[model samples]
Target: MLYIGLYLVAAGVGGIKGSLPTHGAEQFDESTPQGRIKRSTFFNYFVVCLSAGGLIATTFVVWIEDNKGWKWGFLISTMAMLLSIPVFLLGSGFYRNKIPNGSPFTTISKVLLAAIINSCSGKTTSNAVVNMATSPPSVSTQKSSDTKSKKGQEKTSENESLETQTQSFKFLNRAVNNTPVYTALKCTTKQVEEVKVVLKLFPIFASTIILNCCLAQLSTFSVQQAASMDTNLGSLKIPAASLPVFPIVIIMVVAPIYDHLIIPFAREITKRETGISHLQRIGTGLVLSVLAMAAAALVEVKRKNVAIKHDLVDSTKPLPITFFWIAIQYALLGSADLFTLAGMLEFFFTEAPSSMRSLATSLSWASLAIGYYLSSVIVSIVNEATSRGHHKGWLSGGNLNRYRLERFYWLLCVLGGVNFLNYLFWACRYKYRSTGSKK
Candidate 1:
């Protein structure tokens, strides 16, 4: 987990650092029609390919894990990362351009907005469900047949159905081929190129905050929770690390529902031409995070009280009769993920400049670094101070055995609240700039 976290930090920072304009002038605009079209194509290809690669790579890792130890798996992953460097650096030269001197906050704003959009897309599922529930029912009764020959009428209906199918396929192809990033990539100007790079990197960099917070919890507090509780699934006793599996399983089930049933409904009812924006989805994730922490806090409170009753000894194992805390953590985290992760993918791919889409994905992973640092700082201060005297407060000595983790989790709830509020303030103020727009 630590290695993965470090890797995320490295890649995310590199992406952010690399996206800066290397030259100082704007070179292209929507008026440059041919140039914009090519650039857009490049962007589309970059996003689709990069996303596919990551998906493939992750699947391979999972596959190898069952047959081989982590050492071999890491070795292969490291090799893949090393192999990709040359290509990224080669692409970087094409992407580099200069930025005008202005507020550093512009860069910050860009990152924040990118993050917000990604989050909005992430909430596609919830939005879909809401829309589905409210939509008017469809009337499917067939009209009485006209007096023409039944065979002729049947042939006409079949032709109509075939034409509809053909149109649907064509529409899907157009959607894939006509993205802005793809259009931008074929362009020659530096300005258009720079814009493309920004779109590519923004989603990844922005996502790091939430991702780090989430992924880190899987190995740490989550593990501790399992260890302190009775983890029996039927007759099988599970390991602490296995706790993450529950959330992963939930994700698998929920993902299909969101993609097939929710997103399309949301796009239709919200009157949002592109469905909910990424930022809105991320905001929903932040809200779910608050609930997840609250659940953890409740569990901690229960554990703490139990410890006090059992005399707080390391050897005196106070078994929690129920493993409902585990369920809460899994459910809350799972729901949060449905919004944030998917949105981040779409957000980074759409916003990133044409040449550096992979870097954008890396940036999303990097948010874990920031969240980890924050979690670490909070834990250190609380634990160190508590250990100084006889009292552990929330984290000291054996208090956690008493389920004091609840307090720490509550603190996270507070942090999530603040994060969400700040996010909302920024999102409302942001003005989106479409790539190649005249103004």
Candidate 2:
């Protein structure tokens, strides 16, 4: 029953996270400059609003679980979940609905299969030559080709203006043939274009998983680290679980300042609609994640030293160090999240084809989810690699004081640094589809 309920909750959370943000963003018009600006603001506040709920959970809900009981915590969660239904329904009338054509996976699969089948025939058709061309064609050829390939040309107002986006993935352009090798393998220009957008965004999506891997530590090992520290605040004890409040508060405070003050100032200097480019914002977050890991390592070193000084290294008792020490990493990761998450949401949504915006935006959370899973895998791999011939693994020790946590943090820091370099390689080369973000 417990497992079932957990799975149910996960399903519900996934649905809400994927759908809600896309729906809110659809409310804003992205067709005009003002509308696009307003849409960007919506993504910012979306993070702020999520942080608000987190603020309550980390403080109020966490306190209840610490002092009162776990049952009360569950009860409060149930009530909140029940209450949110009506609140969401109340805004339905004013909401703009984006009706999906079908599952995006189907389109992706069709395009891939078409590209494969059409290319396998080994026919270098005129359409393939046109799409795979490295340089612009002569004026005579352009006019003649346009007349011949009238069907492939997008005449719709939305797709007509951006015909050049499909040029990057030339192989897939074969999928758009009028007379495909197989009838089922035929695709449209919009389909090939959308698939190319998804493929191009892949590297950026994978790069942020390492940052999420760092973030996963906050809930697991970071809390355990706090559990070994002094959690007292003016005679009022605080729970280690509630330590997340530090980051939550930071997000709530910093998000608004970035949107209101920081953005306007940036717009003045850059004269760009999006004050900071999405890739720049994501890169900033990646850099901070590297710093966060380094800070965590340093803090771990400081913590271990204090434990040894007090002769508490072999014991489980709380050391003289304050729980606020753990807040250093939390604060950094929080700020990283503020930049990366908002940037990713906007980058993925604005840059994606209109049909796939919801799916693209959902990739942000998918990266986070994969990161959480990856954290555990990393720990397991570390344990296996270090446990050699009767030597206990760095993180295998039951006592937090006895663990070589600093070494583990150092490993993450190094990985994050490498990931940032990888991100720079791709981000520098990435072409922005949006006019507001054109570099």
Candidate 3:
């Protein structure tokens, strides 16, 4: 029953998550300079809200579950979710909803079919057929009604010439050529270009998966590592799960400093809007994640050495080392998350076609899902391989003190370093669709 309930909740979240970021982003116009800046700034604040929510959950919700009961903690969460509907409705009047244009998927399918047909026929589409495809339905109707109108004929000619000159994804552009066999399958130039934009973003999206795999450690091994260390702050003891609050706090402090001070300084030197490009921001996060994993490995090495030196490796008691050592990696990971997540949100929203913004922005969540899945697979493989030939796996034990967790952290650090290099390769070659005011 608990598993069923959890599955239902996951379904509900999956449905809502895709729409929310695009809906919030639609509030700002992308045409004006100020509007673009505001949209970028909104992405930063979105991360701040996420960090604040996590902070509350790790502290307040964990407290309720620990002292009161699990039922009460769940009840509070359900009430909060219920209250959000009314709060969202309150802003409906102010929203600028973009009306539906025909289905984008249908348009994409037409482009594909048209391309396949054109390829098989081995015949070039003629100028007349191309003109018909480029002209609007209304313009075609007017031409059929009054074939003798010189101005209408000239206007159609101009549009056809412009459509033929489109340079990107030239093969896809063939779908708009005016061929008798493809008259019913023709797509608009804008529709073909939208598909091109989505294709370009695919590689960039795939590159971030390994980085998320590194981040998966935060919720699992990082907490366990902290659990085995001294977590006392004077007379009070800290919860292991609540150790994530360190990163949340760091993000809260770093976001404002980066946005207000660091960005202004960067803008002055670079003379570009938004201070750093979206790709650059994402790259910065990738580097920090590498550093975070390295830091985790080093701290684990120190902790293990201390345990071995004092003959405490086999004991159940917490090690003499402070939990603050674990907090260092958590803090670094949090800062990396802030940079990468905000950059991804803005990049996908701005680069995707207006019609596909919601679908594109949702890729950020999908990457994290894939990352978590990859982490489990990697762990299974490592355990199976190591358990053979009388060697215990690095992560196979009930006791973390006995586990060689530092080796696992170092492996992630190496993977992260390779992923960063891959990200740089794509980010440098990729072109931005919108340059705001500077371009």
Candidate 4:
């Protein structure tokens, strides 16, 4: 029953996280600088609201579960979810809901299939039918059935083109042959370009997965490390689970400052609406994750050293080190999340084709889900490989104090560094759909 309920909750959250950001971001005008800046603000507050909810869950709901009962915790959580429905509905009249286009994935699949099938139909590939590569006909004009007058209008529209056909993804360009033996296999230049945009964004998506893998450590081993330390703050005894409150608080505080103060100053310096590009913001977060893992390693080393000094290596008692030491990593990772999560959300929404904005934005959450699973896989593999020859793996010991967590953190640090370099390569090569910079 508990597993069933958990699955239901996961379904609810998946629906909410994937749609809400795209819905909120699309409210503003995409054609203007002010609208773009305001959209950025929308994504920022979306993250802030999410953090606020997490804070409540970690502090209030957790307290209820611990001191009152699991029943009370469940009740409070259900009530909160119920209350949110009406609140969301109240904004319906004002919201800018996007009209549904046909499924984006279906279109993407059609383009790829058409590309593969028409790759070698050389008779159809000609400069004679139309120079679809250099001067593509608009989709609306093309759909009207090419009359002589409509053909003239298409030529006129081509002269006043907003975006030329890009040279990259040349293989997919075969999908857009000027003439084709099978009409069903013919793809429009717009369709081919949209697919190109999605393919280009994929590397950026893959890069963030490793950063989130670093974040997974905070919930798993970081909490365990905190539990082994002094959790007392003056007169109050804090639970190790409550350690997330530190990062939550940091997120809530930093988000507003970044939106209002930092962004405006960046605008002044860069002479652009987005003071820092989305990729640059995401890169900042990746750099911070590397720092976070490095900090976690050093802190673990210090904690282990203290345990050894106090002769508490094998003791079940808390180490003399403060749980606050773990907060340093939390704070760093929290800041990283603020940058990457919000930046990726806005970047995907802004850069994706209008029809695929929602689908592209969902990749932000997908990366997070993959990262967590990767973290577990990495842990298992590390244990299996290191525990060879009947030796204790770095993470295999029964005792948390005996575990070489410092070594584990350093491994993550190195992985994060390599991932950041990978991100830089993709980010530099990526051309913004709006700006059309090939580099």
Which candidate wins on lDDT? 2
- RMSD of each predicted structure: 17.1, 4.9, 6.1, 5.2
lDDT of 3 at 300: 95
lDDT of 3 by residue, 13-44 (tens): 88777777888888986666677788888888
Error of 3 at 423 (Å): 0.9
TM-scores of all candidate predictions against the true structure: 0.56, 0.89, 0.87, 0.89
What lDDT score belongs to each candidate, Candidate 1 first?
A: 0.53, 0.86, 0.82, 0.85
List candidate 2 segments past 4 Å from native: 63-72, 122-158, 161-167
Positional deviation of 40 in candidate 1, in angstroms? Answer: 16
Q: Quick one: ranking by lDDT, best first?
A: 2, 4, 3, 1
For 139-195, candidate 1 gives per-residue lDDT tens digits of 431333355465455444433322221221121212111122233222112222233
Candidate 2 lDDT, 114-137, residue by residue in tens: 888878987543344233333466
Per-residue error at 370 for model 1, in Å?
2.4
- Spell out the clash pairs found in candidate 3: 129-178, 130-178
